[model samples]
Target: MNAPTHSHPRVLVTWESKHGSTAEISYAIAGVLREHGVRVTLSRADEADIDDADDGFVIGSAVYAGHWMKHAKHFVQEYSKKLLAKPVWLFSSGPVGNPPKPDEPAVDVAEMIECTAAVEHHIFGGNLTPSR
Candidate 1:
């Protein structure tokens, strides 16, 4: 018998954050992968000119007033072709500060996830207050 596994080569955790929290989240995730002896690369979404990384973590922090920071959205849109050809995951940081009102629209991260063929997707609660 053989252990089931993926063919992914490396893991990349890329994020675009405001007030630094999302970066911290990605860093923590990267740290865990490193501890497991997995090769990992991390960069700001704005700097991720990645065609593909055997496996990828496409993290994006939510910007309520608008949406994901432009750079993060661009990273995905710009690399949609490459991402769809490989495994990718997206994450966001937000829901802080002014809580989204009942009328506030819900952010839909699914469309992007499906387009990327990402093995999985996740959303972690983040500080919404600007004071931090």
Candidate 2:
């Protein structure tokens, strides 16, 4: 549904990035949403100020050892109430190199999905160094 010009629907894009890649992805998502005329706000998960006024949310995190970063987990826990009441989407970035199909949600985000009743959960392939 589209909102009137006076009140454009706002979507918050927040994420916990370990090496800036996740942040870049978050920004790209925000840009696309903006191009579609949706008001978007990009913020770090730990620094995000999620509120009831937000129409939707796109939360992301960098997965480490099959788990989302700590700040991302805390962010979800801290704002579970507000997030659950609105349209929310969850995403995680990990599993470098050739992307493999994951049968299930990441360890940390699984609980968040249940808690927020998220509309969808997406897992993105991450960038890793050769040494890593």
Candidate 3:
């Protein structure tokens, strides 16, 4: 179970979904942030308007080949300055399975970059199911 979210202003959640599971998680995250009084918006990583959104960000992507989707990576680069200056939370949706893996670990995409937002990154179990 996930813990409660931190409240903030102008929270933006950007996601990349090949089959929409990543999107679902991103929306849930935005919902929780809104519940906590954060003004949030969920959009495709490529579609986010990063202009003066200097408050906060909640960026996420679906992992593919041990990496974040290309669009999400680009989004981070595009908003690198604003992100670093603001509070940010990064997450990924991947490594779907039932547990018991000694070698495999979760990967957080935003952590790989030089984030501008004093960001905390997390990765959640993601679905490979086509129907999800």
User: What RMSD does each model have against the real structure?
Assistant: 4.8, 3.4, 7.2
* 45-118: candidate 1 lDDT, tens digit per residue: 88876743356555565555636777777777787887877667677666554452323322556556755776
Top-scoring candidate (lDDT): 2
Tally clashes: model 3: 4
TM-score of candidate 3 against the unseen true structure: 0.79
Assess candidate 3 and give its lDDT. 0.73
Q: How are the candidates ranked when ordered by lDDT, highest leading?
A: 2, 3, 1
10 residues in a row with least lDDT, candidate 2: 96-105
**What TM-score fits each model?**
0.76, 0.87, 0.79
lDDT value, residue 123 of candidate 1 = 62
Q: How accurate locally, in lDDT, is each candidate?
A: 0.68, 0.84, 0.73
Cα RMSD of predicted structure 2 = 3.4
Clashes of each: 4, 0, 4
Clashing pairs in 2: none
Off by over 4 Å in 3: 1-8, 98-113, 130-132
lDDT of each residue in 71-91, candidate 2, tens digit only: 888988888888888999988
Tens digits of per-residue lDDT, candidate 3, 2-107, equal 9855446777788888888889998888888788887877789888778574367878778776778888888888778767777777777786667722134335
